[model samples]
Target: MIAPLVSVVVPHYEAPHDLALLLTALELQTHPLDRLEVLVADDGSRDAPEPGPRPYAVRVLRQADEGFRAAAARNLGAASARGEVLCFLDADTVPEPGYVAAVVRAVTAGADLVVGRRRHADLSATAPDALRRWFGGQGPVPREFDEPTWLREAYERTADLADAGDDAYRFVISAVLSTTRRLFEDVGGFEEAFSAYGGEDWEFAHRCWLRGAEFRHVPDAVAWHDGPDFAGRTDDAQARRSRNVEGLTLARFVPGHANRGDQLVWSHPDVVVRLDDTGAAVADVVASVRSVLTGSDAGVWLRDGAALAVLEDPRVHRGEPPASVLGRARYRVDLERPVVLTGATLADLAEVAPVRVGEHLAVRRTRDLHRGGPDPAVLQVPGVTAEPAQDVDLQRRWGHEDHQRRPRFQRSLRTPFVATERPTAAP
Candidate 1:
């Protein structure tokens, strides 16, 4: 098969020596040089990089020195990239000859996001010539640094992310990441709001997962980071501060349990609840919104103007959720009428969603709703039931002892959605 053109984006600062070593490594890649292009995304280096002669096309894209804008620099490179797939590498990271080929293989094999294995080494004494000779089997291998135990264990536990779950985003490191140009644009690139070092990769990966992007770990696609991991280099106090900032920044975009605190209002909510005016009492609508908010880190949208006016909380929206909210939200609950549910019941329902109770529907996984392929598993909860708004007593129901009873429902049902496909460049 003809190889798809791949653009390697190297986010750089002022590490000219390391950049040259990386470029040398890229030149040695087993992938066809004609099908590969390199873009050095300089995040406002002191002296702009002037790379010497190279076989493949090489370009340098620079931005103003506005703190650590690696995220913005990467987006700039991606915007200028014309290749079918985009691979991200740090300036200090040197890829093995097979790195590009292995990463591209994963993408072409149907993985939307692929993270190459990032090994570490002390390359301070190494030069570009030595690096090239090492690839030619003429020099000794560089002394290696220990890999992060946590990361190695994570890959092992998840079987190289083949059985990844919701929290798998934590393992996606940007230094050695690759994805198709289509998926990169689909996820809106990385979060440029991140002006610091970390958190951007996690936020980007989380968004990718929310959009149903498949992730894979390419262990054979190896790269050597110039030094030890950040945790090993920094002092405890400095590390703590960085971690705190990263956690806070991540909480704004990633509503996952690890990043979010109990009370903070995040930019994206975990779940979104939408309620249309079913002509039930205003009290019933209010009760419905309350239940969802109490159940999860959720934002409610009320179609009724009266309900919106009365609901004073910022989490309550006046109409349908904006594209930003809908795009990031993990689950969406559509209520035909006001339904009363306890926090425990609402939590349980979200786990096995695409469930229907009368006119109410809850999409447990919003990506499945958008993917529009085979029907998603829609299992019913044992004690959950939605009764008509008018027939149910919204106020008194909460006080009833039997309200907590396990619900018994019928077999699962399938909901079909229209499949949408984006046009791809012909090979």
Candidate 2:
């Protein structure tokens, strides 16, 4: 198979010394040199970054000097990228010779999102040539030192994140990551709103999660960050305050466990399933809501205002359309008809929810509801099981059977909206 071109986007501020070291390391990558394209995304530095002499292709992209805008800078790099896969790296992080190859292997194996292992070292005293030698294995492996133990444990426990939940994004880091340019642009690129030092990566990861992008941890693909981790950077009061603000901003934007502490104030709902009475008994609706609520902490949006007064449940939200209530939820389940849900349904949803992209998980559908008619599904109770509904038309889609289906579906989970056509390539 022909290897896909890999665009390595390096986010550089004013660190010319560190940037040069990183670029030198890139020149030694085990991946085919012809397939590698290096882009130095300069964040409005006073002096432009020079990638130094290189046999392979290298480009420098610069934007106006803005306060910490790594998110925007990375977005710019992605927009300029012509490769099928985009690999992101910080200016100070230098990768081992095999890093690029490992990233390519992961993507070719069906991983849309991949994070390489990042190890930390105090390269402040180390010479640039020595650093290059260490990365090339010509010198000692720069003193295998302390790294994020928690992060290492997470990948091991999750089996390289195959079993990770929607919340697993917390473990992903932008220091070393790779994904298809198509998927990156499809998810609306990184939110440029983040102008601070942190949280942009997590926010982007959360968005990718919503779109069903697969996450894989490539531990063998080592990249040595030039300095200590963020925690070791500074412990002053101002740094603490800035970190707190970044955390809160991330909570407000990213839903689910990531934003669990700010749930009441946050607009996004974690799990949303709409319930319309149609012709089903109010008792049936209540029972359905109960089953769902019991299974998970999903917010139930009631279509029948009259039923809202009767249910009197705190979890039941009724002020607006289900989509609006969901805000930016990654996925929303629509109950076309009222049917008693089993614990197994909730269990199945939890498992299938993370990997579902461009498709909805279907449980059974009624012929009447399939035709955009009212709920004709009969609820089964006690020992008897309800016969599965057979609606051949339902096979075509997952949501409202009556509503005209769109040619394209938006990755947005909140505020149910569909794009007429998939967004054009990232600009």
Candidate 3:
């Protein structure tokens, strides 16, 4: 196979010393210099980053200084990259000579997203020439720092993410992440609304998984972070507050168990419900939506004129779900008739969908549905039907007169929502 061109994008921000060392390390990569390029995506530093002279092509792209915009900076670099594979690194992260090759090999071998092993070390005293000798095994190794036990244990338990599940996204670290350009575009790159320091990588990884991207942890592709892991940092009131904000920001986009709470309605729901108007009564549609919302963090989209009363609830929307919602949602339910199922049952059904429940209700894994592949499994559940015609007993049947009443939904309305499109390349 022909070697794919790899664009190494380093997000930098007022870290010229770190950027210089990173560039020097890139110069010694085992990957062919002719097939590699480096793009320094500067996040509005006071002085422009100078990559200096290099054997390979190196370009610098700068975005206005506007707080922490690493996500946007990465996206800008990726958008302009002219490579088939894109590798992301932080300005402070320096890779081993074989890092680029190992990462690219995995992507070329069919991993949609690859996360390299990020080790920590005190590189503050290290210089460009010292880094070269270190790679050459001729100099004293830098003092190593403690790796986050949580991350190390996670990788060990997941067998390098070979047995990764839906929540495996938490293991991806942008400082040592790589993917094909096609997969990156398919997942809409990193979310640019992340003006904070963290959570962008996790959010991007979550969307990639939801888009059916295969994930791999490449331990051989190693890089050294400039300092210890965040977990190893000294805890303070300011650090605690920052971490709290990061957790909350991540919770809005990733509906995973660790980051989310039971009562909050996040921007991206775990399930998207599309209830078609089967000429059912307004009460019936409302009941169906309520049933779905009862057990899952779900957003329901009703066909036009289905029911305006339910719209009062923030979770209910008119018309089909937008591309952004569908892209991030794990499951999608289509109902031609009103049906009720507990949240646990709904989750179980999604795992084995496309399932028909009494001919009018269907549950599907949104990723599988988007892929347009043969259904993994077809199932049928008996006895699920539309609501009864008796309108007076609707409240009694649902056990609540205010089923449509709930707390307001809160979410960031970031612009340029990603369009739902099938991945152009196979994972």
TM-score, each model? 0.87, 0.69, 0.87
Expressed as tens digits, the lDDT of each residue in 1-427 for candidate 3 is 6678999999999998899899999999999999999999999999999888999999999999989999999998998999999999999999999999998888877898999999999999999999999999999899999888888899999998888877788899999999888889887899887888889999999888878888899999999999998766858886898889899888788774578877777768888888775687787667667667875688888786557755588888888888788888888887765665533356556566666554455677766765674643445345434333325356576567456567585444885556688869867
Instruction: Candidate 1: give its CA RMSD in angstroms.
Output: 13.7
Best model per TM-score: 1
Give Cα-based local distance difference scores for all models.
0.83, 0.72, 0.82
Off by over 4 Å in 2: 140-144, 236-239, 272-331, 335-427
| lDDT for each residue of candidate 1 in 81-182, tens digit (9 for 90 to 100) | 989999999999999999999998888788999998999999988999999888789998888889999999999999888788888789999999998898
lDDT of 2 by residue, 121-207 (tens): 877666678877776668866555578888989998999987896567788899898888977886777778788888889888876
- Estimate the lDDT of model 2: 0.72
Q: What is the lDDT, from 0 to 100, of the residue 128 in candidate 3?
A: 95
Q: What is the lDDT of candidate 3?
A: 0.82
Residue 337 of model 2: what lDDT?
A: 56
Candidate 3: regions farther than 4 A off? 309-311, 342-356, 370-427
Residue pairs whose backbone atoms clash in candidate 1: 382-407, 383-406, 383-407, 384-407
Error of 3 at 15 (Å): 0.6
